[model samples]
Target: MLHGGSLPHLTPEETLAPILSALESVLGSARPVALHQPHFAGREWDYVKDCLDTGWVSSVGAYVTRLETALQDYTGVAHALAVVNGTAALHVCCLLAGVIAGDEVLLPTLTFVATANAVSYCGATPHLVDVSPVTLGVDAIRLAAYLEDIAELRGDTCYNRTTGHPLRALIVMHTFGHPAELDALAELCRRYRIVLIEDAAEALGSFYRDQHVGQWGLLSAVSFNGNKIVTTGGGGAVLTNDAALAQRARHLTTTAKQPHPWAFVHDQVAYNYRLPNLNAALGCAQLEQLPDFVSRKRALAQRYQHAFAAVAAGHIVNEPQDTRSNYWLNVLQLHPAYGHLRDALLETCQARGILVRPAWELMHRLPMYRDCPRMDMSTAEHLERHLVCLPSSVDTGSVDTGSEHA
Candidate 1:
């Protein structure tokens, strides 16, 4: 018996066997291997079939409305606007937040590229700040320092000299389904008159205090991509408590047209960013299952944590405890003191057929973001080399047990 030891990291053979078994049992031996299979059943199928049958499979339909309604209920936000994807949702939020060209949007560098890309879409500069190693989210003290430095250098209350622009907004990304420092970020935004937009793409069921992730910001976004916890295959939504901002986002996403019968008059430039009814139907079904999915994912995470507790000493990583997370992707950060051993461990996991992946290269270090203003991301750089994402799925099936090192 392994006793307090974590279970062995998965081998490719081990990972494939269960998926193959499920497929053989459900779809027969004809199906090929798949990394992920949608777990839709019950009302999900009903929704998909009904959508096809009604010929309301395109962008506009009752299903879209239902998705919006369900999202509002699930997140407790006053309004929700479904969009084609998370990027579109963030773009629309930046537009509504008045993030114009030459303005700077403060954001953490340790997030998906899209989080920073959306700022570029509006022609605004992204000021990528370093993150706290503990939370893997933006550092509040560092942010304040950046703001103060800019204010002093520019002799302006709002503009930063390094970026050569006024910091117009703050885009807070909830990294890996864990809620960021929202309460502190919110207060900072308010004090600076900076618009706050939460990138809750990875944090659907995650919460800060008692409120859900999407409900914290003035404008917030969520993604339902194929790899996400609750996927609509490809869809996203923006949530807001401000009635006017919600109305404006909806208007802009649907082509910014004035209501005219057959007039086809467009008032301003807009985007073809509305979610298709078919996708929305899928979203609605997924939303219905989110609670169950969250519960199962958390349970799986607890198992991983228990396993890791044994091996995580000088070189293993573990989860944070300040806030509850949706556990979208279970991460293990190798101790930096492990040095070259981090790469060796990653190679070992892969050699054993486990699909462990490194943290995204710090966005500021990426070729596209190199020119963007960035504070020295010492912590992000340290974590980047060692953090690994395990093959986490709510449908772990018989492979429910796994080892993790803290």
Candidate 2:
């Protein structure tokens, strides 16, 4: 039959019908759909025009400060520094988190490459940790158990007993915009004197127990990529509540230059990673529409959940308890019995103009990270096989109408 082994007790066609119907229903039609794309129905035009007309389109301008101020006010963080991109923001956070050469940073195995690559940029090793089956993120209780088995705290520093590398920080990513268990994780990190950072790149409007996702950690990063809930074409920001940390982030992202007008006097080596004013202008416009986007996305998730509930082969992932997600991308977790049916469904959906994608391969399985220290990733492994990202882009009315409405 269809190349891969057929499902038991069902022919290829028999197994494909229900899934196909469910996919078509959730997509709202059979029209071509991107997994997630920017929705720009705001004052994007006027802002970009303002920047171009005034020639204040570089990294320095009023829009940069305006965007930073907007983010600070929205997230309730004390300071926000706009940056060139999410990866650059994460690198700066790693530097400010005190990550050094040969140090170890704890992270999840089932995450985007950017999450792990950021730790590597600091010359530190990424210690792969397992995630939870329910929340699909780092399990605070489980991580504590694993650390008890292998970690040793001495003189206010935590170290891997076997490898002798200092466990410097823990980077908790809000997987698929679902807020991680920050309360327990924060207390645990506090106990071991481990620095905490949040990779909130996928979670712009997500919240946990009434607090914003990025506010839990000492420092956090949010992305405004073309595909994120809100977009700035390509931009990111570092967030923090502490004034000292915020000042350091601002200084480091600006190439560490001395504050002298018309003087090129320099300080320490740093990065030219500030977000351009042109992009910040777009961000200011996008930020204004974020709440509306989040609302529409939540409604879409509900539709998917209801549609999938009637189909036996499908299950829609909803927000975790005591939390609110922006529903950046809706995940369709198939029944374990139908795991082998996914590739066929994915192929069929694409042939019918629907885009569906699976989760990223676990970091420990990658060739470069093959030798890194890690715990068992059974849950992440299962998720790697069965989860598919459905078309969760915010509703722009119909696929015919471009995502340009405000």
Candidate 3:
């Protein structure tokens, strides 16, 4: 409701108190509430029990295969390989993308650290880019222009002439479950011959123009971490439509074992990043309840939107145009004038037993990535100052049927 303009604000306490009270009522407790947590309203126990009863709790089991099938079906991607975590999936994507030492992986600066860390794990430097104020994802227009101004086309590959490093791929994060401008970004990648990898870590059920977020890029990674829309405790998946890329991902993640009945033979130096069967069992159950979780989270987002309509200081972050978000983490970006109140609001909420968190510091600001090349990060700086992650756990089985039942 506080759209595109500043509002006349009272004191910070006066402004945030009502919002906290509203949250307390919705959450059904004055006790501390987590930002996000796993919800097991379906057959999670039964699936895990099956793994336990069959004694197939490790990497090898029916559950792992079933989980992959569920992901492939839900996401409409041809191939899905379950891995240990989202970071593992990203690292594998880097390897498969042909990113080598001294290569530069372009990504948005306003995302979680895992995206940059994954690029670092591949021995490539991260090239942080600006994000759109509205979408909170990379800005395609700016990215294309930046590439043109600083990059060169050396035959088939694009290289950042400024840094003298080949630009291997563009890693776009679907920030907070809202699908980015995939069509524009994909076209840019094509023009520059840059491989595209979608870090749909928070966007398991999100879509852009009816196409799932993870299905558009050359390869994508989805996280099943506890905070994501769907949780496998500690699991993730790599998704791609290309059979060759999918097969390569599977082989590389499973330690490149040359299939032999009992031979200890490995064809290449690979990572043991396979998701454990126990986690996959949990993932299978979570996938079954994903639709319901998505629905309930959207309902909560609607409630927050309506509430924010009455409050002038906060604007509820919603799905961007032509996109359907899972609303994984409900967000509010305070007006810049009131951005100074961010710390006060966070502390106030946490003291009142509601856990609210600010966005991560820009990757370029970090010491490890300080030297990485980047374009203007002004928009990301604005976001880092204003945005806040609110409580958005699945409310399927909440005890309090109050406003949270929205």
TM-score of each: 0.86, 0.95, 0.96
- Candidate 2 residues lying further than 4 Å off, grouped into runs, are 1-8, 396-406
Please give the RMSD to the true structure for each candidate, in Å.
6.5, 3.4, 2.6
| lDDT of candidate 2 over 1-406, digit per residue (tens) | 2223344577767877877787677676647778887877789999999999999999899999999999988888889999999999999999999999999999999899898999999999999999987778898888999999989999999999989999999999898899999999999999999999999999999999988888888999999998899899999999999899999999999999999989987799999999999999999999999888899889888878777776666588778899998888899887777788878888887888787788898999998888899998888989888898888788722554447632
Give one digit per residue, the lDDT tens place, for model 1 in 54-161.
899987899899999988888899999999999999999999988999888888989999899999999998988888776788877777776767643333246676
Error of 1 at 397 (Å): 4.7
Q: Which regions of candidate 1 are displaced past 4 Å?
A: 1-37, 152-157, 313-322, 397-406
Clashes of each: 4, 2, 0
Candidate 2 clashes: the total is 2
| Ranked candidates (lDDT, high to low) | 2, 3, 1
Q: Which model, 1 or 2, shows the larger TM-score?
A: 2
Q: How well does candidate 2 match the true structure in TM-score terms? A: 0.95
lDDT of 3 at 329: 89
Global fold similarity of model 3 (TM-score):
0.96
The Cα local distance difference test for each model comes to: 0.75, 0.88, 0.87
